[model samples]
Target: MDPPLSFTVPQEDFLLFHQVDRDLYKILVTELSRDPSESMRLLAMWLWLEKVGFHNVVKNIMSLPIILINEIADETMLCLTCLTNNSNTSLTTIMLSSEANDIPLLQSVMENEISLKFFRQNCMEAIHGVEKTRKEVCMRAFGDIMQRAMMRNIAERMVENNNFLFGSTGPINLQFGSVGIAGALGQQHSNNNGGRGGIIPADERTLFVTFSKGYRVEEWEVREFFTMAYGDCIETLFMQETQPNEQPLFGRIIFHKVSTIDMILKGASKVKFSINRKHVWVRKFVPKRTNTDKVILPGETSGFGFGITS
Candidate 1:
């Protein structure tokens, strides 16, 4: 089949939104492929919707919000249709250079698995419509995508730290604990450990806590339950916020004395608690150290396993 060119969005935009796009693409490939799960169709669409919304905002196109949503939503449906029917239509070809291949993101995916390909009579078909309810759905979808990308908190902080960004109150979190602090210090978890502690250091007194695989235990439930066993020895209790329904997220319990951790660990990596029909666990808290803040030197790879050929 003769390859057709698609220029609905600029080529550079794909590389610009690479992380979110790539993530969305991976999900789409799985969901839109043969044997697609009818159960997961809604989830796949939400992920796709958020990706498109993020692009709309960053590019400052500000088209009617509904337009972008319908455009992307349609593309999603079209791709699903293409895969399901298994039509004999020639697989879409994107030349990187041909005048070459197609859009970088689309072209790159086609280079991978065969069943994940999509065909559009024209690229513009994928983008050009809006529904009556526009901005609200758009915002929620985009915000959720940011959460999936783990960039929502940083965006929230950027909003709060700047007077230019806030409206009357601040943006409301969609998730229950979306904006709530899952981790904080002492009687009032209003503060963090405040960098590394000076004297004993936070880790010496902190015990890492993990729950069972089935349920998501809340931060408060963890604190109240553990306080019974460890007593007032608890200095602070904190848990990381993640999916409220799926994998059990972990937490930290800092005791007043270092000996508490010794008693809990007892020369093992972790200690378990089976109380009130739920199993909880405790270990030593070791803060993750990352150089993500540091800039890559001129010749360094970006850690994507590929060198900067540029």
Candidate 2:
């Protein structure tokens, strides 16, 4: 029986065999075997070898069994022809057109995580003989493959935070009241409870405002003014009315950042700024006790210091 083919071909050369002809095949094989560790460096060397006259090196390398040589050479030639004809073909088309045994090798090249320099230097060099537009299309295909590989790697590393709301420190023990009967009664007697465990505390970023007498607070006007003053940091702004058929006596403003509350309070007091030309007092909101009486009597204030009657 003929001696088995002694040399194991590099994966890249196997994928790009069509690009190698008899005149340049020897140089291509030599370059691919230069440094076993650097795949991309070897690829660059293969692309640099120009097609010249036949040499003794080519004869020696082709001394392998006729059957094996013809198999690889034929596959390479067919792949090269397909690529040269359809330079702008998709990667899938390139892979599908290749011989069945070579499919895995072609897939490996398409999925290889090489740098942009590899595509620009080696990949572009392989298609140097093609038209400029066709060359660009080929480079773009290679670039798309690299980009997809990078995105997939990034996505794999990104672990979803299951406890994002509570945070990674673990679930917080938010106690409604202390443990025992006293705690239960304390919670029950607390007017802020509203028949629940405890009153929902006001967000630190929110501000409670009491408008000056004879000033009718408009929700849109307040929102527009605060939005202009604070830019996008003002998340929410709305007027609060306690009595029916009456104008809004107060308003609430919630900021995107809690740190901005102190800054705004200090600045508002210093400037003596008012919303809609009326004196407006602003302070951090404090959760209030729930009242049984739904309606605010004409002259009574709702403990927030804002009177219904001017």
- Among the numbered candidates, top TM-score falls to 1
- Candidate 1, residues 20-115, lDDT tens digits: the string is 433343232232221122213423433333344422322221111221222233334445454344443433332111311122212211222211
Backbone Cα, N, C clashes tallied per candidate: 11, 0
What lDDT would each prediction earn against the true structure?
A: 0.39, 0.39
Runs with alpha carbons beyond 4 Å of true place in candidate 2: 1-202, 242-245, 267-272, 289-310
Q: Report the lDDT tens digits of candidate 2 across residue range 30-142.
A: 32121111222222222322221113222332433222222223333334444445455553354443232232212112223222223233444445533331232223323
TM-score of 2: 0.28
Scanning candidate 1 in windows of ten residues, the lowest lDDT window is: 99-108
Give the runs in model 1 whose Cα sits over 4 Å from its true position.
1-198, 242-248, 292-310
